[model samples]
Target: MNTWRARLLPPALAIVFAAVLCSVVLLVSGANPLATLAEMIAQVARGTTAVDIVNTAGAYYLVAIAAAIGFQMNLLNIGIEGQYKLAACVASIVGGAISLPFGLHAVVIVVVGAVVGAAWSGIAALLKVYRGVSEVISTIMLNMLAIGVVAYLVPTFGELRGNTQGTKIIPDSGQVPGIPFGGAGTMFGLVLLAAAVGVGYAVLIDRTRYGFELRASGLSSTAATAGGVNSKRMVMSAMLISGAVAGLAGLPEILGRDHTFTLNFPTGYGFAGLAIALLGRNHPIGVAFGALLWSFLDKSSLTLDNIGVPKEIVTILQGAIVLSVVVAYELVRRRELAAEQRRVGRALGTAAAPAAAGTGGERA
Candidate 1:
């Protein structure tokens, strides 16, 4: 019961708090909060909307897992935005330029994405380990740099074919096949990839030696160092792993839909991934739920304009959830710590009672 409470309570409270806050915001904005919320909820019954939610949740899941990896080692890898973009762009170019057997082609593109992402993220990791530079600063700068690089390369490498200008169009052979649902639409094939990644993440973190060292380092660097865990190695490994996953975050859209990377590809996934990671408490299962909830809000909010409610209300609600999760988790942690201390104190007192009585009897 306690374990379940610890696992579920923070998220539950956070969602409730976010709901109340959003209701107030809606009222202040002269919108009917309940009606607006009901409309969003009702959209889930539509097959197309359901497909969009699943597809989006899959992408968000991958990103959140990426963020969770670095988070596990206490490395703030804010550059996933850049990592995924650069990787997807490069992968698209490579994928489109080459022709190969069907399965081999997709595998090659995915590998290229992972490699490019790791290489980009390694820059920050190397700086942090060797120069004592903060990854937060390095990653933020890298994001801006990535944007310039992409802008320069896209127009240079990409030819304007028809109205759309992007890298060479990936041939059908390189595209990931989608799973069709009659009225819902086809789901991204990479959604399965996201599931596989989540399972792998859980196994690696809970069952592997590397995961132990990573967790140890996050909890206390000095203690980890004393225990013979190389802090530098763990940091580098964690960041690289995180980047590799982030690289794949864009592949769903690229392979399943766009079949190429455009200059105006989606952005902000990196920061959203961070928020989802926190909301999920860094657990793979928890993150999956968080991603689904996020995707639902995002996809459903599209019709808010029709209902005379600002879609930005969803954004405000998401922000509220993140804030609430942070504050609630901290409070819960403090409460648990206090309870633990009291239990230990009582145990010590009980253990000492017999000894004290024996000593007094002997003295008498």
Candidate 2:
């Protein structure tokens, strides 16, 4: 209960702060901040929008949770961008290739996409574990490389979906098929995916030995090693699992949900995931809510045109929220470190004082 409250406070405060700051900015920009917020809420209530904000939120959740898992292990799988891309490509290509029944085809696409994502991500993990490459640099480079690979493969070999230059749109038989919501844009599949992420991530972090070791290592590498945990293995497993989660995001996006492969269907879900992970404090459950909040903000920002607010204003709001959260986290971390140092220093001082007193007594 206490833990839940503790996790909830930061985001709650951030939202309030963001609201006030946005209001001030809006007032200065000759727009009513209150009106802007109301306009956004009204749009959501009216269910008259070009995009499904909730569904997009689900997409961000998928990516953010995956990246958060990697972050927990002290590994920044910047490769999530590449991981999602490769999974989308591999799954779309392989899934469209098969002509199975509807249910079977959906399953095939999801599984294939996830596996492909993990496989692609494994390259970064392999480099870090074996070749001594930093995941940050490798993942970023690999993301660009994956993009090139996709361009080459799609134009050259062609997917079974009937593509001449790029892969063809997936057939109905291969689609995960979304349930109607509001105006038939939002899907029930999204709800299921969110639940699965929450449950799966929580289990991976709390119920597994790997999670325990990773947490320990994140806290202190030397202590983790002393505890007999194979730090290197933990790091590799962390990367692999993180990659797998990132791979899963592609399922609902390309192969499962869209049944199509476009040049860039993913609108920066990977980058958004990093922000979500940070905001949620890297807790799986917290991250879930964070994804929802981001999705709301992101989708509503488009509606700014209705109230005459510039799009850049919305971006500024997001930047402010991210900056505030980062600052708060750093401050909290510093205080904890300072407290720890004081405790250690006090113990050393006490031990030395007693030793000096004993020496004086013996000399007298």
Candidate 3:
């Protein structure tokens, strides 16, 4: 098979298979799949629904890119959940306390979030590099630690009003303004930040020497070290970059929508990002599509209950898509490996035959 075909076919097939399977399931459960589809389509056609999808997708895009960075380096960095939360907490406090010019204040809050996230992830990186602690284990523990710290500090240092508990509201100078879309919806201005992050991620991973080193390290640490790639530094750098991007995952809500870190601030976005990253195969463009699809499903699911269709069907469909895509990709990878080995074997055989004939002539 052609290399590009091999790369593209699996994902395409996975989507088809998942859709067919979901249709069958819906039919078996006595629901009208076409009606359900129409409902989803009608709901998404609304301007408000479109705006909500874009707004949510912006956050998912940041989270997916963050996970993709670690994934490219073979790191899990499960602490993304904790990293974003902690960064948001600290950034909210700092942003609320200060009153600077609009642009500078926003920049400071973003910087504070990125720095705190990187610092939190650094703990897992150091443990992995120096103490041989598995990042999966360490990051998981760090997540719990982060939550505990946030819980403790919020009550002590954060402000609380009657029936509302959260950090102080950020002043207008620190808030991110929204772009109104014909009064039907207001899009978060931070969507530009998400776009910038995507562009930066693409450039960093595809065009830079450091990206080559990171890819090499992920492919084979021993080989990367043999080539003088400095595996430790690459691992640390990737982790920090991942965490820095993770920090932005919550900023759309914080700076644009919420203006403070409330106890009810969104959670679980990081875990959703992990799934999106997997679905995207860690590619920036792929991640964008994945984020949009995930967001669409989430938004469209809201209308499912109104039509007497189980909303849980969307959850099942999502799970099936992820599982199917993963299996398809793995199969493609193995097939590619086998094809490469066969090509190498044929080349070797042809070369050996020429050398053997030449040796026979000499011996004769």
- In order, candidate lDDTs are 0.93, 0.77, 0.89
In candidate 3, what are the lDDT values of residues 27-119, reduced to their tens digit? Answer: 999999889989988898776998899999999999899999999999998999999999999899899889899789999999999999999
What is residue 35's positional error in candidate 3, in angstroms?
A: 2.0
Better of 2 and 3 by TM-score: 3
Candidate 1 residue 210 C-alpha distance from true site, Å = 0.9
Residue-pair clashes, model 2: 0
Per-residue lDDT over 130-248 for candidate 1, one digit per residue giving the tens place of the 0 to 100 score: 99999999999999999999988788888886776799899999999999998889999999999999999999999999889999999999999999999999989999999999999
**Candidate 3 global CA lDDT score:** 0.89
TM-score of each: 0.98, 0.86, 0.93
Clashes of 3: 0
Q: Give the winner by lDDT.
A: 1
Error of 3 at 145 (Å): 1.8
Mind giving the per-residue lDDT tens digits that candidate 2 earns over 174-235? Answer: 77656666573656364577668778888878998877888888888789999998878888
Residue 260, model 1: Cα distance from true site in angstroms: 1.0
| Over 4 Å off, model 1 | 162-164
